[model samples]
Every structure is written in structure tokens, then in C-alpha cells.
Target: MKSTMLSMLVTLLLIYLSVCLVVFLLQRKLLYFPTPPLLHFSPPMEATKVSFENGGERLSGWVVNEGRAKALLYYGGNAENIEYNITFFKDNLPDYTIYLIAYRGYGDSTGEPTEAHLYSDALHIFDQVTAEHSQLSLLGRSLGSGVATYVATHREVDKLVLVTPFDSTANVARSVYWMFPVSLLITDKYESAKRAPNIVAKTTIIYAENDNVIPRESTERLIEAFSHRLENSILIRSADHNDISEFPEYAVRLKRALN
Candidate 1:
């Protein structure tokens, strides 16, 4: 009977080890999906290549609508390409010159992507754009919203728009992965909540009413965090995680914020 009990214990230990190994391999897919690929320049828009020198690594992006009335710098979500977003700007917000910054490892940009690297790349783009355009606005969606918030905290700008923004990456992870220790495991913190209070610019945070990916409760925490820290701010209605920009209210809110 003792030998049988010992065998059962060994069997349970092996099963536990096997599960751990599988989780270790699949964790990356759960953490970071839709990795960037090779560049495919758009055929329609007039794209100008802008290269920023970052510690011997060259980060590249495209400036769409180079010479326009105003300039808007957009830092996109995790699974985005400059070529795809060019149409959104050209079709909807053509009044402003658009800079489509491809995060490192996304689009034509070379080098591995990390939270710190992407934030610094955005600052470099902002410096170059501010040199030319008198009126400048910053926009970010999803993951890029975190990057945008960082920029808004540091710089003086006309308007700042964060679409489907989150309070912090750790907050979201806690909501989704309550059973796991994702908050500790996640490498990219993207702690927008800690930085939102520092934004002095006119800010508009557009939260989706039906955003499944980012819990509405956490978004409320973000809004409250903003109100407690920042002075001028507004929240838009009927915006979702991906389709908030489609609503006409979004454009109206943007115009109001900028003006």
C-alpha cells in the first residue's frame, strides 16, 4: 500500500511539471499577439520615410500627408500597420498632416519592440513634427494610448485624444487573468494611470460603452484618475474599443477639444 501511494505521488508531480512546461511555451502567445511583419508601402498615399537614430538602431516610420494645414501624430495599437491607418486619416481627418509611427518591429522599422523603446521613439517623432507644424495634436488607440499618455505628460500640446484607453496594463491583466499572476509576469507595464495625472494639455478620453476587451469598470477608474489629477478633460459617448472613431460624436468631440 505504501508503494502504491508513492507511485501516485510521483504521477501527480509529473503531471504538474508537464502543465507548467506547456504554460511556459504558450504564455507568449497569450501575452503578445499579432506580431509585426515586413513592410508593404501603400500605393495611394504620398509616404515620406523618417528615420530616427536610437542608440545605433534605426527606427523608421512614414509621414503621411506631409504638408497639410495642421499636423497630427498617431501612435497605433499593437496589431496595426502604417499603411492601413493612412486611409483612416486621409478619409476622415484630412485637415491635419498625419505621422503614422510604426513601433519598432512593426512595419518597416528595424529592431525589437519593447515598452521603453516605443515610448522614446514617439518622443523623437514628436520633436521632428513640432519643428514644422504650428498646431499639433496627439492621438493614440489601445496600446498606443499608453504611449500617447506618456507624451502628453511630458510635452505641451494643443489637444490629446486617447481612444479606448486603459488605466494600466496591470489592471487589465488582473481583470482577465484573475487566476494567474499576469500582473507580475507581464513585461510591458504601459502604466497610463500613473502618468495621466501629469497631462496638462486639453485632453479627451473616449471610452467605448460596450468594450469587451477593456472592462468598463477599469476605464472608469482611469477617468476618475484623470479628473483627480488633470484640470481640463471630457469623456465621449457611444465609443467602443475599435469603432469609437466611427461615431460622428468622436469627430465633434475632437474638434471641440482642439478648438
Candidate 2:
């Protein structure tokens, strides 16, 4: 009986270690989806194709309502194409120019996506956009929230919006893989929660009532981390993480936040 118990314990330990190794090796693949532009996609008439060079790689995207005094830069989810938002932004926020810059390895942007590269590229994109528009605001959703927080902490931002955001990628990973040591295994720790206190820009947080992708606990933690009171905290009722944007309140809340 003693021998059997010891053997079972040893087998479980090996299995746990094997799974940990696999997760460590394939973590990047799991985090970044690198979605290409959708087929039959049409660029909004007001959108002009623009590109910026960062870390020796050229990243391309669209700039709408160029020369406007107010500008908004949007950073999307890990697997998002970002083009899907061009028309919506063009229609909603006429007062400000819209920037739909793609992450490296996403859309027409070159190179692969990593936390370090994305953060650096975000700053580069911000500097490029600053040349034309002085009043700049940032909008980030899901994984991009991490990038936005990093930029907001390091740069000067007038306004900020986070949609379905998380406290950090490490926490989210731990929530999913409770059996594993996700904090140690996570390669890209987008610790937005850690940097929230330093961000002083007028901020708004839009989260789904039922966000399965990012637990409410994670989102709430980020909200509580902010140093200043949020301008708005709108919740879309009966919304999931993926379909939250589809809810009618999504665009309405976003428009209010950006404006």
C-alpha cells in the first residue's frame, strides 16, 4: 500500500513538471494570435494608410480625420485585426482623429509580437502621431490594455480608456491554470495594475457585466489601482468578453469616454 501511494505521488509530480515545461515553451504562441487582415475588408474612406518604423521593423495602420486637434490611438486585443474598428470609430468620434495602428506581427505590421516589442512600438507610434495631433488620448482593449498602461505611464496622455481590461497577464494566466505556477512561467507580464497609480490622465473603464475572458476580479483590481477617480465606469449588461463590443452600450460608452 505504501509503495503504491509513493508511486502515484511520483507519477503526479512528473506529470505536473511535464505540463509546466510545455507551458513555458509554448507560452508566447498561446499569448499572441497574430491575426491577419480579414478578406473582403474595406478601409474606411476617411482612413489614410500610414506606417511607422520601430526597432528596425516597419508597422503600418490607418489614420482617420487627419490634422484634427484631438486624436485617439487604439490598441486592440492579441488576436484582433483592428481594421474592424475603423468604420465604427469614423462614424462615432467625428471630433477626434482615429489611429488604428496594428501591433507587430498583426495586420500589415512586420515582425513578431512580444511584450517588450509591443511596448517599444507603442511609444514609437505615439511619437509619430504626436507630430500631427496635439491632444492625444489612448484606448486599449484586452491584451492591448497592458500596452496602453505602459505608454500612459511613460508618456503624456490627455485621456485614457480601457475595455475589458485585466490587472495583469500573469494574474489572468494564473486564474486559468490554477495548477501551474503561472506567475513564474509567464513571459509577458503586462502589469497594468502595477502602473495604474502613476497614470494621471482622465480615465474611463468599460467592462462587460459577464466578462469570461478576464475575470471581474482582475478588472476590478485594475480599477482600484488607479490613482485618480475614473471619469466613467460603464458596464454593458448581459455581455461576454467577446461580444461586449456588439452590445449597443459598447459604442455609446466608448463614444462618451473618447469625447
lDDT (Cα, 0-100) at 18 in candidate 2: 95
Assess the local accuracy of residue 24 in candidate 1 as a C-alpha lDDT between 0 and 100.
Answer: 51
lDDT of 1 at 9: 100
- Local distance difference test scores for all models: 0.74, 0.89
Q: lDDT of model 1 at residue 117?
A: 83
Tell how far residue 161 is off in model 1, in angstroms.
0.4
What are the per-residue Cα lDDT tens digits for candidate 1 across 167-210?
88878878876755666566677888888777877777777787
In model 1, residue pairs whose N, Cα or C atoms come closer than 3 Å (at least 3 residues apart or on different chains), thus clashing, are 208-239
**209, model 2: CA deviation in Å?**
0.9
Best candidate, lDDT: 2
Ten-residue stretch with the least lDDT total in model 1: 228-237
Q: How many backbone clashes does candidate 2 have?
A: 0
